[model samples]
Target chain A: MLSCREVTLLLSESLEHPLKLRERMALKIHLAMCDGCHSFEKQMFSLRGVAKQYVNGLADELIKCEDELPPPPL
Target chain B: MKINLEKSTKTTSEFLHDGEVVEDLRRQMLKFATQQLGDFHLAEDAVQDALIGALKNVTSFGGRAALKTWVFAILKNKIADVLRSKQKTVNVSSLQGAGEEDENEDFMSLFDQKGGWNHDDRPSQWCDPEASLSQKDFWIVFEACLDHLPPKQARIFMMREFIELETDEICEAADITINLLFVTLYRARMRLRECMDMNWYQRSQNHAELS
Candidate 1:
């Protein structure tokens, strides 16, 4: 049996990408029964969304820089 | 199979003609390098160096990873070289060693024994990246918090979370295992969370006093 700590770590990973079906089922079952873990999952999803936005913003700046660059020498 | 030199040359020329491919790759490399070095100039230099090297050795590419990933891998090597050159000039003895550990420990404690954020009462809120940049104070504090992260963790977090690279691609480029990636990312998030929370609290206090 995974401790809450182990489960929480896995929960974070799951938010980043798809988990194996078995792993997903395990997390789902645990979250279904555990309020704390469920809340943790929600928080992880929220954090992921925020982080994605942060990166997208930086990426946009880099893209803008690329647009401003001169065309390569002929 | 007989080698077709003419066909090979034609294919190579056709590949080179795909300007969009090169632009996409350059953008990705610039973003990855910038996030890793935390300096725009250094990142630009690293990307240029990597591109030159790539052009020189384009024949060696086996087409295993995506072109963007390959360019990023080269940029990582270039950044490492840059770091090595810079490391030679820094005096290690002048730095406070114990203070670093204390800071790391303080960050680790924010996660309870269960490895979850200690504060469960407050719900995490999602913010738009483009919108957040409009608030200059948020960007300043966010950038400051980013600076506080250990280099590797900061790079991984920025690449994975910010740049939105796939985990496997990051693992391949950074040459780190999946588990290390997760742990580093977790630590990075914990530190940033603490930094943001503290900044928000201070801002709130200031507003209260002004009122």
Candidate 2:
């Protein structure tokens, strides 16, 4: 049984990738019994989505500017 | 002998033409450096220095790495040199004053009141991912929040998260051990989260209520 603190750390990493099968099963079971952890997962998911969107937009702006830049001095 | 001399001159001219190549590389490097350094002046200076050094030693570029990668490596060194020089000039006491008192107190109080990670009861309704991203206000707050991070952590986080570099490359470029890299990234994310939640999201919510 992972405590909320342990689960919180794992939640962030897991959102970045899939957890192992056992870890996934454990998290699912815990979420079934724990509303707090469930809500925490939802918040983490939303936060990750927001961060990715914001950062991706910034990356696009940089890429666009890089494309428009003139060739370097000889 | 004249023909040989002419051939040698042509080679030299080609090398000078490579200077143009170096400039293109610098522009690409500047994009990364500006995002990493968060200071346009520093990024510009670093890019300039890297270009001069690359031109002076153009023959050394043996095509091992892509030209962009090699230029980025040089800019990374320039950034490190600037940080080292700045570090030496700072007084220890002044360093302590940097983000130490008021911000830490505010953050601690907020954590205590909110009951740490366990009590994150803020609603799941987030800024519209597509809409907020296109707004200039979002960029303003985003850049401000990023600039507020401690320098080393900010560099690593920006490289890893914003530039989408590999973890191994970030560790190598930043010259940090894996554990230190992870710790820095965690701290960066936590601070950004706190700042965004406090500065941007709450104010937007307040404006919404009033309107």
Candidate 3:
């Protein structure tokens, strides 16, 4: 049984790299039983989602400005 | 890849008509450079120089990498040059004990002596986190949290997550080892997570209580 601390560490790493099968199984077993770890994992995913949204919004704003600009001179 | 290869035969002159795209690219470069350099004036000069250099070599830009990434690569070099000239060493070692703020303590406190979630500080279920994405103020707070990170951590985090730079590119640009890069990225994400858990989640509770 992986401890919550260990599980959380793996959770973050899973964002960057694919977990080994052993580590993935251990995380799954732990998360299946632990509500706290489950909630923590969900929070991590949510944070990534929100961060992507914010950055994509910036990209969209820049594109919008480009659209509004006057046509380039020949 | 096939489509890009097909389009690569067109000369740069055919695509150079849009001044607006250049202006927008300049703005993006300045913002990204400022994040990394933490100095508006220096960032401005770096972006200006990068823009001129990019324009001079515009014909050499194959349609391989995205335009933003190519411009950013140049800006990265320009910023590095300025930082090198300033003689400001990037002290990764001192980061461990750099401040009295006790960043290590803050992270440690989240875990119990038994290496499990601390009872009091363990995460709670956040309601409709997706709903907050559409709210403009959420990003304002998010960017504020990003800015609050140590400059080096923030710069690397932005390059990796926001700007979508490859790890190899970031490592080469910053001259950091892979271990240091991973550690810096982990610390940055932890800080940002803690910030959102407190500011966004806790604030919602406070607002509900007020109503």
Question: Best by lDDT, which number?
Answer: 3
The residue-by-residue lDDT of candidate 3 on A47-66, one tens digit each, is: 67665444433233211110
Deviation (Å) of A57 in candidate 1? 3.6
Return the TM-score for each candidate structure.
0.50, 0.49, 0.61
Query: In each prediction, how many residue pairs overlap at the backbone (N, C-alpha, C within less than 3 A)?
Result: 1, 0, 0
**Top candidate by DockQ:** 3
Taking all chains together, the TM-score of candidate 1 against the true structure is 0.50
Which candidate's TM-score is highest? Answer: 3
Per-residue C-alpha lDDT of model 3 across residues B107-201, encoded as one tens digit per residue? 77788877788888787876644342334445555667777887667777766675556666656556766666666676777788777767656
True contacts kept of each: 0.15, 0.02, 0.34
Candidate 1: which stretches are off by over 4 Å? A1-3, A33-36, A58-74, B1-33, B38-42, B45-134, B201-203, B207-211
DockQ: the better of candidates 2 and 3: 3
TM-score of only chain B in every candidate structure: 0.45, 0.45, 0.55
Candidate 2: segments with Cα more than 4 A from true spot: A15-18, A32-74, B1-32, B35-42, B45-123, B127-134, B204-211
In model 2 chain B, which range of ten residues has the least summed lDDT? B89-98
lDDT of candidates 1 onward, in order:
0.55, 0.53, 0.63
State which candidate, 1 or 2, has the greater DockQ: 1
Relative to the true structure, candidate 3 has a C-alpha RMSD (angstroms) of: 9.3
Cα DockQ of the candidate 1 complex? 0.14
